[model samples]
Target: MSDTAREGDAEGSGVSEGASGRTDAHESGAERTAASDESSTDAREPPRLDGWPLVGNTVEFVRDPFGFYDRLESRGDAVRYSVAGDEFCTFFDPDYVEQILVAENERFRKAQILRDSAAGFAEQGLLLTEGEVWRDQRVRIQPAFTPEKIRGYADAMVTYADRLCDNLADGEVVDVGDAMSELTLKILAKSLFDVDVAGRRAVVREATAALNDRGDASGASAFLPDWVPTPKNRRFERAMSDFESMVDDLIAERRTGDESEYDDLLSILLDAEGPDGTTMSEAEVRDQMVTFLFAGHETTSLALTYAWHLLGRNPDELERLRAELDAELGDRRATMADLPDLPYTDRVLKETLRLYPPAYVIFREPTEDVRVGPYHVREGTNLTLPVFEIHRDDRFYDDPDEFRPDRWRDDFESELPDYAYFPFGGGPRHCIGMRFATAELRLVLATMARELAFEPTYDGDPDLTMAATLRPENPLEMRVERR
Candidate 1:
């Protein structure tokens, strides 16, 4: 997919300029602040929208995040607000997003809100850590997702997808969202651990759902101490405990068996080392395993669910995709080798990811005082990168909301700036499993298109839910007909 970069260097006057958008990159500490003094929105602090006494915009945000942010976008490039006693800056510009994630990444760190919310569930996994430790963990984890390693996982993904379809009959109505979730989880377990998690799928699914719900709640009251046992908090604890036990058992099973027996992500991680020449402890390994289970499966499942939902509504796109699949692999299951020949199918999935990115929004906090555009941001300032808004910004995409796979036909993505459509994110912290997820998504979409025809049970868009990842609020129910 083509991504057109905006003009002007990111380093010019410490401002990253896109086609029309501009954001200030927090350069050398003192110099950046000096430059910000001359900016247009030169205020003592970022623009703040007034709110209630203590809760700030928490209620409105919890009630409807997308709508709240969409409304906030009209106010300014960056809007500061208080939430549950703390302050935050919500950035709508892609240039600002890029600055925080790339050019001046060192000045920022992963938001503590996420770490506190997921701590019990994910522990000290790479997703939560920062600084040298995070860098080391990333180095250790990077090799597992290398191109060669991901290509090795394609067959397992396709095999599991086929297995999920085996029991379905033509014209049978099924919850594609639930099915995709289950299928991806199974694929994750097999692909990562070389184990069948189908037996424990119920436990894993239930636990994950509870955690996501609790996480959403946690975001609203992040200032609350973790020891407080609210009813919801108690339930979340139980779910995390259950998941941890399962992971511990899985690790134990591997320990007793031959580590040399399988070549999976678990094996690689178990043997991976930090830059300091230290191997990961078993507990650390368990944390990473759980992280992969959720991150690996949830996002991919959402992509598949949306792909089918969009295809059901857009027959022309569906036929075009099927045409590519038919022309490439008439009657056989799609393999990694067939990726080059499946360009249209690739575009369909790409478009789906753009419209419905699972990791839709990310939060970061400045390690020190910083400058974002004309605003002077203080240390410990919470910054939110609203990727969803940027992806749909009409400044970059012609019909920002439409599902047009044909838009990706040639150098479309290449024509846009990097942060404009980062479904998997970008820069040093870009998702390590991107290549793996891409391969899995394309193969599953291709395989399903070749095997079944999907018809949506309900018309219009599916209700969206933002858990840890964005997903359909309800089951994406569809009637399936065999090809």
Candidate 2:
């Protein structure tokens, strides 16, 4: 089902994986000495592996990247895999990441694969756009996520978080993941639109979930053009239609002057002006709203999922977090003004994101022939950096798999290199809502930690899944007990 061609060897350039243990750039010609295989430092090729036939390693990849990475790293870091008739590779090495996001960024832009693939849902929003458009949108829209604006959203963020905690009865089993999703959606709606969007949350959630399905691009759905007729196409269309309809209604309602209208992302986008002084149109506003909604609602919730699961297993970290909150809030509430003081809470979030970055591959295309790490990428080639694998590398992190927040505590702060822990991505095109997402996360975490504690409901080992976002394969069934 998933493609697994001879992914190890790249186009007759035989990168032999042998017992001799040489895994690095294989030299082939003059004036180009291959990268030395630093055995003591790293031996993994990149993050890619050569797969078989037309299917490449898609099937293997969809199953479990962690396991796949373990095997690939055992052989070498960078392994080449073919997909969709293209020679694409996934990279876990930080040097490659730096090349893609920083050093050679001007030459590499977001690959067209994601842009065209995601065309089903939304087109050319912040995520898919390239070059000038992305630059302009980011510049105009970034100011809204300034610390001051995030601070403004904090009170409402705390309020919704506490309300979520309050609803958690001592003995009831709850899905913390789903609860956080809903909580964030509400917070976004109220703080941005000044209206409670509980009525519209489900349709939005369902539509969003559809966008995450890798299956849409697989099976029968893959055969059809994005606009063509098919189940996946229909699903994509309906979701897009519903999301836009909601935005249109909100905009119309805002035009008529709802007394409740407040200054949130929607308002900020609508009011944002490019250097040329052109404000975003209603359609642009809608796209930006969904983009922020996808980011604001989904990523923060998934981060919480990983954080909760890790904390549940680590009593020491849990107790430390509780102590931090108790000393700061003293059973009151996580206030906007108090955000500056919660250092440990921020540490937990950073560590969670470091361990389980919500974004998978940050893609870019080469504008010119360039070297990512060891691979000499020609122009028009697409490059992807797997943030998930890189974050867990022992090189950047000590005992990488272990859930230790203290890794980010002392010298680790100064030690964190650029592109090392890019949960929000990097470059000029990095997420504009980074500050906002952090603000939302802190609010929800503090409020929930004060009142509710989640105990996972799984009987055996925890399950991990990589759909649109990395999460527990099943709904996070957990007992939500009030403290």
Top candidate when judged by TM-score against the true structure? 1
Candidate 1, which segments miss by more than 4 Å at Cα? Answer: 1-44, 217-225
Candidate 2 Cα outliers beyond 4 Å, as residue runs: 1-48, 62-65, 75-77, 214-230, 258-262
The window of 10 residues in a row where model 1 has the poorest summed lDDT is: 10-19
RMSD (CA, Å), candidate 2 to true, equals 9.6
Q: Scored by CA lDDT, what does every candidate get?
A: 0.75, 0.66
Compared with the true structure, model 1 gives a TM-score of 0.90
How well does model 2 score by local distance difference test? 0.66
Q: Number of clashes in every candidate structure? A: 10, 27
Best candidate, lDDT: 1
TM per candidate comes to 0.90, 0.84
